[model samples]
Target: MADTGAAIELVGLTKRYPGDRQPSVDGVTLRVDAGETVVFVGPSGCGKSTTLKMINRLIEPSSGSVRINGEDVTGLDPVELRRGIGYAIQSSGLFPHLTVAQNIALVPRMAGWSGRRVRARVTEMLELVGLDPGEFRDRYPRRLSGGQQQRVGVARALAADPPVLLMDEPFGAVDPVTRGHLQDELLRLQRELRKTIVFVTHDVDEAIKLGDRIAVLGERSRIAQFDTPEAILAHPADAFVSGFVGSGAALKRLDLTRLRDLGVPGCPTAHQGEPLPQVRARLRASATDEMLLLDRRGRPVRWLRRADLTHAEGPLTEAGTPVGGTVTRDATLREALEAVLTDSTGRVAVTGPNGVYAGAVRLEGLLGTVRGLLAADRGRAREHQRERESTRPEPTPPEAEGATAGRAEGDAMGSAG
Candidate 1:
């Protein structure tokens, strides 16, 4: 599978049903940059799905062109074009009779990959989506949970390493908790793969969470506003866009920033198998009363307090309260805030790949970050207002026009003198 991310452009894309008075999608022109995730969000029946399918010619655009990476794909054979574009839909869309490995191998096989290569890709993709190839490869779809099935669906989509991925409410069928996990997984994958993604969903928050840019659609697939989540949240284009943004625009801004962007400071720490005397000495020297315990692999295990050290005659692993609240660096600020608020500790542990300890985020830091973000947004809004005012064409009053011209001429003469 090639590691490629392609730019997608739609020019005047329209879709009409036979004998219908209005087209389902009318003149939707959008550009999704390579390695960007662009989400299409709108009310139900707004033709977001129809517009998504037209990219692969599944719905077949009635007019306009679909270009991938610079080449026009509208004239290309639908089958070959689809082979290059990964599409995943709602409900996992897995063939129930087929095993997970078989389902994932479909695309690679269609491209004439050898059996060994297809098998290797199947294993690689499953692992890429956090599924164990040994455990899940041979299991039928019926044997898997909704979340597991969705992971397999994603694995299948990426098996051939398509440059572009089209996902239509792929996580909508799962429970809220599972949906969140899937969203987090997608973010992690995007960070690594950087594929161009066009995602369709009616959930505004989801769009804000996943998209690099969001296209808010209205009737007949009219794009009301297309911009970054921060821009749209700070300044909606119109009433329709504002209504779609709903309340909590400020909180939604938190999703635009990730924990990695903030410099998460490290706290005092101790390893599990360290000597009890050494651990006691370190804890006494530490500024804080608490220390984070890590396993041999450097993953967070427990939080040790100064008092717990006195009673610990044995291994440090069997000491202090178990570390409960944890978040990955890929987690958004909102998620980190939620974890910190729920935990008894004022801070939450941040981890990297394979649960390795990265750093920690404190409540005070998050509060300060949020305040800074709001202040910056306000500043940008003011600047945009100034720009608009400067560029605006002001109409001259009929009576004042002659006076204004005379005043301008006098000012010019005074400057010359």
Candidate 2:
């Protein structure tokens, strides 16, 4: 179950409808490895949905093939194939008439599982999606909130333990807060389940957050670029990919990027009750202009400038004098950037959830991470270019004059006749 491998593959896939001058999807070829999540992203009407639907035969392809688990699924019965794969949509699509358990059990029941097995599976799925089975199983969709219904949608999709999951904007219908929660939940689930997931979304942020790899779709369903989220964000293929990724890509990079990559040295720190001279001495020892003041419990309180020590303040025990912004250690690079921008000091205090001083992040460290990311991206690009050049067919050398003479004479005689 762990190593199913290449759960879905599309080779030269194209789909065209009647009277259409252009194909909806033109020769799309991509593969999704088992236990990996790939997100297809593009502007409206870019044929991403059509490409996904073709995988389960929801929309038949005009040509080419769709294979699941190394088997060509294009010829398989569409209904049976879909039943074995998990499918979730924007609106949850739960049946209001049925209880939550019944809605979740729909697929298992359709597959002719015994009622006891179906019930057990339904209960498991409900728990998996963060809904208590005892409470939500008997409740109808109408009794749940938008977020709740979407959770139910995910539960129903996983009811039969499908190895492949197809999600088409599954959280699109929920509010921003709920959408974020659902995204985190899905990430947690994916970490545990390791299902091969194909998630389609137009949100670049979401794509960067959830996708192990991203397929950037362009007009006519052409794949502009396919790579890991970090690579895609760092090095977009063209103007379309760049614009689609949006203006704040550098800042967004922080969200996907981590702080550990940035080599940040420790800054001088002092407790609140420390003498002013001692604080000044620590600041001078660190060769820095300011010192971070920590509370009695060694939690960050505020920053103290060297000049402030010159005043009559007996100690640097100031309660709250321009502490600046603080961020958690796990906060994305993007959030750190925002904190730096909003604060005047261009520095952010890193603290744990329990309010313990973890470390500090300065503009220098942040810049270093960005540079490292960009450098790695450029290296990859050069390698890809080299690969393409080496793989390209070389031209044949010119032949001797007599080599094609007979063929040329025959062609001339045929044309004359």
For all predicted structures, in order, the TM-scores are 0.89, 0.67
Q: State the displacement of the C-alpha of residue 49, model 2, in Å, after optimal TM-score superposition.
A: 0.5
Clashes of each: 0, 3
Model 1 worst lDDT run, 10 consecutive residues: 1-10
Top TM-score: which candidate number?
Answer: 1
Q: Give the per-residue lDDT of model 1 (tens digit) for 309-401.
A: 998887887889888968888788888888899987788899977678998888998999999998987888899999999999999898899
Residue 343 Cα positional deviation in candidate 1, in Å, after optimal superposition: 1.3
Give one digit per residue, the lDDT tens place, for model 2 in 1-417: 222324788999999999999999999999898889999999989999999999888899999998887789876888988887889999999988999998998989998999999988988888788788898989989999999999999999888888899999999988976776677678767867888999999999888888999999999899999999877876788998988999976567656864434534567788877767777777777777776788887788877777776663665664336575676554556766777878776888876434568788888668777788767766877898899899998865467445577689989999999
The clash number for model 1 is 0
Off by over 4 Å in 1: 1-3, 391-398, 401-417
Question: Model 1 residue 185 lDDT?
Answer: 87
Q: When superposed on Cα atoms, how far off is each prediction in RMSD?
A: 5.3, 7.9
